[model samples]
Structures are given as structure tokens and as C-alpha cells.
Target: MIEHIIEIAFYLSTALTLFILMLPSQYGPTPRGSSDSAAEPKTTVQVLVLGDIGRSPRMQYHALSIARGGGQVDIIGYHESDVHPDISSHPRIQVVALPPHPFCLQTSNRVIFLLLGPVKVLFQVFSLWWILAYRTKPVKWLLVQNPPSIPTLAIASLVCFFRQTKLVIDWHNFGYTILALKLGDNHPLVKISRWYEKAFCKSATAHLCVTNVMASVLKKDFKLESPILPLHDRPANHFQPIQDDQERKEFLLSLSETAPVRGLLKEGKAEVIVSSTSWSPDEDFSLLIDALCRYSEISNTSKPRLPHILAIITGKGPQREMYVERISSLQNNGKLRNVTIRTAWLSTVNYARLLASASLGVSLHTSSSGVDLPMKVVDMFGSGLPVVGWSRFKAWPELVTDGVNGRGFGSSGELVEELIDLFGNPAKLEKLRIGARESSSYRWDDEWTPVAGKLLGLV
Candidate 1:
């Protein structure tokens, strides 16, 4: 019995040795951060842009472009369906994949993600801390894209505290108010989240806000001394004009089948394109649709029929089903005379093309909906499309100088009135289009170059 056991053990040991020898030397997940001394010489400016890459393509493009343009820029972003390929290709731009939490979003593949959530969070936290500990001596600046969340901001603050690196908070939305409005103010989760937000904002050395309104709120409420730099997220310049005239004609012809184009060019039928992600109370797209339907009822038919409105409502959320139902009901009842609703995942390039063809763009939300100047607004500028919608938030008024580039409406009644006025007059639309192009030009460059330069003392 002893001799047989000895023989078995010897064979097992020999097999294990063979397996190890045959196995590949390098076998594991992709390496994180810089591995070689080559990335050592240049200034390392690590920028973390977490959550919703698709929502801010133009902003992401500019941020990544600027980072790579100067020195070593390491970018860690959340996993979106379509990722920016440039980041993957760039030598300096490191793309860290962040898996979504199952607890936060619903999915059939729940168990796997639920286990992964805690693991990912721990790994990310550890990786960030490791960067702080090891890379600080060489690192120059640390920029957090929207340092308003606890896990994200905590990492930024902790790194800044010990590493002695300059901390930049990219304030996309009012941390507390956005969560309170999005997930309900009474929510226990939001209450805890706000505490982290306040701490991070206070500790930040500098900030980048979407508009002057956000800066004011941060100054007044947070009592933060950090320079709240006003930067505009420029529109993504991906849309190339249709080279083939025949192809363009066919595409327009297909569109005419659904809704007849009555003198779209001759009489100048102004097309209003509204592409909003959220149909929630914050977005208030329902109000715009309601106001349009109301205006269509009262407006005179003899007058050049108010530019055939074509509003494309995209995205999926809690309010998605209800919004689709509402629009469908309007069409069924013949209440929606000219409005058209198209729902789907819009590629950045395709979305830009749609905006290019559109005569006007609109973004509407309530007063409470602050800090969320939808990235679509930037796309509107990139496409050189004028805007017309409710401008209650502080950013709206500043970004879109009402009556200059876009018309601002306070109430639902005002939104309706403005739409009517713009549709009735074609020349006003032309002037606004010119203004939009001019107004948005500054915003495009502001995203990365000037902001990064300011942070690095290069500006």
C-alpha cells in the first residue's frame, strides 16, 4: 500500500511540472497603468471620467484628445456599449474597464454582476490607492470628471491629500440636487451621497462647471474656494456632409413617406429636432410635446403651416414606456399633426448627422433640473443647429443667451408661444442658426485644452 501511494504522488508531481512548463509565460488580464520606463519621463496627468461615456462623446473626445496631445494622460472610464476607439489605440490614454453594479441597475444576468460589483469596487479602490501611493512622486495632476459621488470623490480627495497632487473636480451636475431630483430627495441613499459630495468639493483645488449658473450655486451653497471655471462641452465634429446627392435624395424621400413634406424648402418649412435622453420630470419633454400640440390647435392654417415639427425622443428609462405611450396616444387621436417620435440607440456619428439636417434643436427641463445641460446641447452647436426650449436652469441662460442663439421659456405657456413664434417666422430661425454656431465655438475648445492648461499652469 505504501509503495502504490508513493508511485501515485510521483506521477502527480511530474504532471504538474509538465503543465507549468507548457503554460504560457504571460497569461492574465490586461495590465493597468504604466508598465515601462518609457512613460516615466513625460508628465503623468491621470484623468478619471466615470459613468456615461456615450452621453458626453464630444466632451470625452476633447478630454482624451487634449490629454494625449500634451503628455501621458491616463483615462479610466465606465464600460459603455460603444467605447471610443482612439483611447484604446493611443499609447498614453489607458482605458480602465469599470463593470456596472447589479444592485444599481436591473438585469437578467444579476448573480454574476452582483458578485462582480463588490469585487470591482474593491479592485478599483485598491488600484486607485496603489496609483496614489506609488505614482504620486512622479504624477503631476489628478483630474476627476464629476467629483460629486462618494466612491469617486473619496478616491480623488484621498489621493490629493497624501500625494500632494493638484485635484480637479469636473462638476457636470450639482451632486446633491441631481441625485435628490433623480432618485428622490427623501431617498436614504441620496442623504448619504450628499455628505461625500460636500467633502470633495470643499477639498478640490480647482473645478470645471458647464455654465456660470453651476459656478454660482457651488460658490453659494458649497462655500468652496476652488475656482469654478466655466467650460462648455463642445459639439462632436463627426458629421461629414453627404457627398452623393442621389443618396441624400433617397434618404429624404424615405422620410417623406411617413409624413408629407409640404414645401419644406420653397416656403422654408423649419424642422425642429429635439433629442433628449431623459423624459423624466427633470427633462420635462412631455411639457414641450403638450405645448406643441396645443399651439397646433390654435394656430391659423392659412399662414404657412408652422414648420412641420419632427421631434425624435430617444433613450430608455423609468419614464420611457409612459413617454412612448403618450406620444402614440397623441398620434392615434390625431392630436399630433406634425410631430414624429423615433426611439433607438443613436451612434454619435448618426446623431450628429440628424442634428446637421435639423433647422432647430430644443432642450426643456424644470427649474430644479440644474447642472444637466444635456450633452446633446453641445452636439446641437457642433451641428450648427439653433435651439428653442425652456431655459429655467442657471446654465441654460448663460450657455444659450436667450433671444440671441436660442429662445428661453419660463413656463409651459411660454414654451408654446416661443415655438409658435419661431415656426411662424423663417428668417428668425436663420439668424438663430448663425448665432448657435458662433456661441458654441468657444465651448468646443474649452473642454480639454484651456481647462487642462489651466490645471497644469500651462495656460
Candidate 2:
């Protein structure tokens, strides 16, 4: 047994040596003020923001908040098609794009990901280490987004330790839960990932959660003692509703010719319902689809005076084609006449424009993390578009108050009834819209600036 233990230790030491050799050489001694002792007051705080998922807006928001708070931020993230302009154009912000991963990995193929995921992750970690440790200026803090479903915190923690920077993980969703959704909860990899997640989260210097419920979960489930700030998404300054009717008309006409809005356009007046979905199974968009279909049936058969419906569904995902086909089938069968459904994968500007012009918004997201609030709902409220959201999430009450700013529903039947009642009464719809606008008076900058300042010790 002694000989076996020695052999194992020898192999582990060898692997450690090989890993050290593989890392890029550090450039000279650490600069002054780069050490932990250098946490003194500085004119400009430098922050390194890392995000594995490129499409996430939370990272962008955080970066903007940091920049607006007088920090120079360097964002290292995966390449994405629709990068937000505010992040790209900020004077103090630098955006670094990672080389695209292989198509197989991008598609989330379980077999190929299992085969090549480790190698790919190692490459990414090395690239990040080289950037954070050697390439960029000394950073005071490293803010990372979780739920790339990988153990990124482990890598960030090591980087922070060596660079003498604080590591702040903005927990969006737990990787283990996402893994369990993709694989089974009993899978060996899932179990291993859960262990790693707990370990790394416990090691972080600070945590920022999307909702208060998530912070509670971190404390109870992971036993994480790190100071956690619940920084929910808020509307940017640009998300105001379009008060001009001509601008709304022009915006409606700028939509794709294939969009379902043409029916509404011809009617001179229309009821525009907007909903955003990630197209994942967790969202249960079928509920909204069923509600829309039922609303159409009721409008045509029961109430003839209801305005024509133009339902705009925004976002693209793996399940997009399936849902698109489902909606198309309903339209072809003439079951959806009073309502025309359109699926649009829009840029940030166009999406905001669509939201600003919308009469009502629907959010089907059921929060795969159960604790994190649906950001789509936040964006809807930001646009002053009243929302009909799922009632199940722990954070629902904090964002949506039934019969107030927005309403929540537990079932498709309830949602359909609510939709019918709201659309049938213009006074109620207008009241909800006013409530949405009033509720969204709080700004992202207002909520995040102080929290970010506190996290960075800038306040």
C-alpha cells in the first residue's frame, strides 16, 4: 500500500509539472499596485470581464456599469453575431473575441462534447490565463458569468490568486442543474460537475446573483459565505416607449415582408402582443401559442370588435424550427386568423424597437434555475410593456404583482382567460400599460452603480 501511494504521488507531481510547463511564460515581475497590498485608492479601476456564453446581455450590462462607474473594462467572450453596440462602442471598454469552437461543440452534441469538451475547455482556460496574467493590464477585479455549464470559476479563481485580484462570479444559473437537464441527474459527469460547482463557488471572493432567491440558494445549498448582491436586470435609458404614432407606423412597416404584421398594418389599428423566448423546452412556449390560438378563436367567434392581433415572438434557439413549424401548421389550418404569429431573430436595436411598440408582452420562461428571474420579463418591464408571466419562479413576486404592473398565470387556461379579458377591455389594457411604465422608472444605472461600486470598493 505504501508503494502504491508513492507511485500515485509521483504521477500527480509529474502531471503538475507538465501543466506548469504548458502555461505561457509570465511577463516579468508583477507590476507595482498589482499585489494585494496595492488595493489602495486608484484613479481608474481596471476590470477583466469573462463570459463563455457570448449572447448573454448580463455580462454586457455589468461591463457597462463598471465602465460608467469609472472603470476601464476588458471583456473576453466568445464571438457572437449580435454583439450589443453600447458594449462595443464604449471608450473605456475593450472587447476580445475567442476563436469559434467547432460546429459539433457549438451545437451542444452530447457525444462530440463529451469527446472533445475537455480539450476545448483546456484551450479556453489557457487562452484566458495568458490574457489575464500576461497580456492585459493589472486588473483589480475579475467578473465572470457562470452557467457556460463548465467549471470556469476554478480557472478564474486560480487566475485571481496569481494576479492578486478579487474574483466575482455573477451566478446566472448553476452548471450542475443545466447539466442535469441535458444529461440525467444520476450521470457520473453531472455528479462531478455539481461537486466542482460547489467547490469553486465557495472559493470566489464575491458573488452577484440575478435574484435574491439565488443568493439564498447559494447560502443554503452551497454553504457559500461570500458577500452576494442580488443585481436584477433593469431597463437601460434607451428602452422608453415610442410615443409617436408615425414612428410606430414606420417601424411596423420596416419589419420583414414575411412578418405577420402586414395583416395588422392593413387594419390601420391593431393590438400588438410581443413575447420573447429562448426556444428552449423549459420555456413552455406552447402555453403562449395555445393562448394565442384560443384568443383568436374567441375574437372571431365571440367578440367581432377586437382589434387584429400581431403576435411577434423574438429569439432563436435549437427548438426554434419545431415551434415555428407548429405555429405554421395552426395558421395553415385557419385556426389562427384573428391572430398572426411571427418569429423573428432580431438585433438588439430592432428588438427594443419592437418592444417599445408593443401593447402587451408575454414571458414563457420558467427559470431553469427556479431562483433566477427571467430577464426577458425585466426587459419587457423596461420597455413599459405590461407582461403576462409564469407564476412559478421564486422571484416572480418581486417583479410581477398580479393586477398591478403585470399579471402572472399558473396555467395555459388562466393565461388565455387573462388575455381575453385584457384585450377585450381597452381601459384595463391601458391601465396595465401605465402601471408597467410607472414600475420601470427605476434604471439599471441606478440599481447597479452603487452595487458595483461597493463590490469594487470604489464607493
Candidate 3:
């Protein structure tokens, strides 16, 4: 019954996604009422920001920031629902929708790509050709993400060939190396993806890597001199170091009353929140969920029974049902007696508020996970929550310290042990909590704004 339900959900999701893509894209917002006669000729600093920017809030923020930061920026991507923000509010911002195609998505399972097989390959090729033939002429500077969109970058490279444009492929996830490891070299898709990565690296004039590890990997593995600009997303307003006790208490109290947070503040029950934008097979969430279930069971029966731990995950993904089922199964088996798992779509504001209420934040990715730096970590620190993350990819260790800001465990077993420790000693958790708050300001946007200014020649 579970398997049948999952199959139905999967195909429904795929069909819906395909339907959405096939729909004709009515043009989105542009600079209000600026007539062609009144409009000045676009200066040479024109940039086209492309990819799945709608998936997360930061992506939209970053795209809009670049657009509004005085460059003639044109954004092309998905805007699924009615919750679209006024991204092109600035005089320079222009948004164009990339009519739907499967290759534009970052998939959770590589094996699923095999299910589409020849149709997938042909579709990608056709998408690439269509994008190249149609939108290739106008864009002078191309910014894109990896994996499914690597082919788009390949097409962008071809666009660069025609126009003397600078191709800026943002290394958000290490696509080629990750896919190669997951699907093996023998797979036709993997080979094409690796070739696309190699070609893009070789062809792109500038590469924007989101982390030092990604930059290092590109240089070492691919032998490309892609000078990386760490693409960090941070809050626009920088709060002064959270020093005063009253201020901290007030802030915590404020976040405690949010819709999703109300359940955590029962009379005597202690509560902690774990959140994510992406939860699927590729991510190491099972380890954390398992640990939480085990901890909840043992603690619920203790002398000073531990509080309920709620894992509130929000994001639409292929393996969401699997995650839901796993957590539900744990609950049914009585291991998650004091634990609750809820998965729903959340707006950016609600999501941020939820993160702020977390006593400790948790994030994970598997060794084969493609995303280089989970964007949620940026929100975690930005919200002043201590993070407890698994060291799956190369970047988590650099972002977190073992005993200081947060804890980084090497494997699933180690992650379980670390969660136990975090839950065991409240005093230690408080200290780490302080460290987490202190470390919130170290994200890429804070460090890269000046560089971004220089890139746009604002200076």
C-alpha cells in the first residue's frame, strides 16, 4: 500500500511538473512604465541571472540584489505559484521566465534520470538547443547553477562563442564529480554531465564558487583556474553582537510564539526545531531523524524527561514521502513518542522565523550530495541558532567548529552521538548556542558584497 501510494505521488509530481513547464510563460514584471523612447540604451554592464532561483528565498534575494545593484540585469527562471515577489522593482531589473523543462531541475535521485532514459537525454539536448537558438543573443554575462542546468551552461558557453560574453557559472554544487561518483563513468548521462562540467569550466571566463572547498575541488580535480567568489547569502540588516541577556530573552520569546513554534512551548516540555529546504535520499537526514527518535523515546521515560523534539521540514522534493514515511514509521513503532515530524511549504518569512526559534539547528548531506553549501545553514546562522550538522561534503567543517559555534560529526554514528551530547548537557548547549549566534555573520554575502561591488564596478 505504501509502495503504491509512493508511486502515485511520484508520477503525479512528475506529471504536474511537466504540465507546469509546458504552460506558456506570460512575461513577468519589468521596470514599471519605463517606455522604450524614455529608456536609455542599456550600458555594457548587462547581466543575465539564470537558473532555479525560485527554490529558496536567498536565491531570489541574491538575484534581485544583483539586478537592483545598478547593473542591467535580466533574470530568467521558474516562478511557479502566486507567491512571486516584486523582484524587478529596481530600474535595472528585468525578469524573464524560462519556460519549463525537466533539465532545468536539480534532481534528488540520479537513478530516476535513468527512468526517463533516452527521452531525458533528447529533452535536455532539445532544451539546450532551444535556449541557445532563442535567448542566446541578448545575454552578455551568464550566471547559472550546476547539475541539471549544466547543459544550460554548455549552451550559454556556445552563446559566449557568438557574442564576446563572460560566462559566470556559479558552483553551488559540484555536479560532475558528484554525478560521476553516483552514476559511475559507464552511464551515458554521467559522461555527458562530466563533459558539460569540463566544457563549462574551460569555457567560462569567470567561475563563482560558493565555498573554499568547491573552489579547491574545481582547481584540483578539473584543473580549471576558476577564481571563485564565495556566493554567501546573508540578511541585509546586520544586528550588533547579541550581548545583553534581556535582549536575548526578549528575542527568544518573540520567536517562540510563531505558528509552527507554538507546539514546542508546552508547560514543561522542552523543544528544539530542525528544519530544511531539501530532504531526500541524497541527504543524510535519516541519521538525524533516527537519532531524534531514539533520543525522544529514551528521554520521555527519564527522571527529568527530555522535552519533545520536533523536526519541521519544508520543501517539495521527490523523496519527501519517503522521509515522511520514515519518520511516521518511527512514530508508529513508539521510538518517536516525544517527536513530531511535519513537512509543508513555507514562505520565506515563516521559514526564517522558524529557524530563529530553534534552540539548536540541524543540517545534513550525504557524501554523494550535490549541494556544496546548504543555503539553510546561512539562514541558521543568520537566525542566530547553533547548528549541529553532519560533515558529509567538504564545506561543513569549515563552516562549523567541533566544540565552538556548532558540532560536526564525521558519520551517521558520530552524528547520533553528537545529538545525544547536545541534548544531554543544557549548559554546554547554551555555550554552543552563544557561539552559534556569534558565528551568524560569517556568511558569503557579508564578505562578498564589496567584491560584488567591484565586479559591478560600483567602486
Which RMSD values do the candidates have, in order? 10.3, 3.5, 10.3
Clash counts per candidate, in order, are: 0, 0, 3
TM-scores, one per candidate: 0.75, 0.89, 0.78
**Candidate 1: tens digits of C-alpha lDDT, residues 402-455:** 777888777778877877787778788778877877765554545656775655
Model 2, 189-219: lDDT tens digits are 8899988899877767888888888889888
Q: Of models 1 and 2, which has the larger lDDT?
A: 2
Ranking by lDDT: 2, 1, 3
What are the runs in model 3 whose C-alpha is more than 4 Å off?
Answer: 1-51, 56-58, 81-88, 102-112, 115-118, 124-137, 185-188, 230-264, 367-371, 442-445
Angstrom error at residue 455, model 3: 2.7
- Write down the RMSD of candidate 2 (Cα, Å): 3.5
Clashing pairs in 3: 232-444, 232-445, 270-307
Per-model CA lDDT versus the true structure: 0.63, 0.76, 0.61
Candidate 3, residue 15: Cα displacement in angstroms equals 34
| Candidate number achieving the greatest TM-score relative to the actual structure | 2
Worst lDDT window (10 residues) for model 3? 23-32
Model 2 score (lDDT):
0.76
Q: Could you tell me the TM-score of candidate 1?
A: 0.75
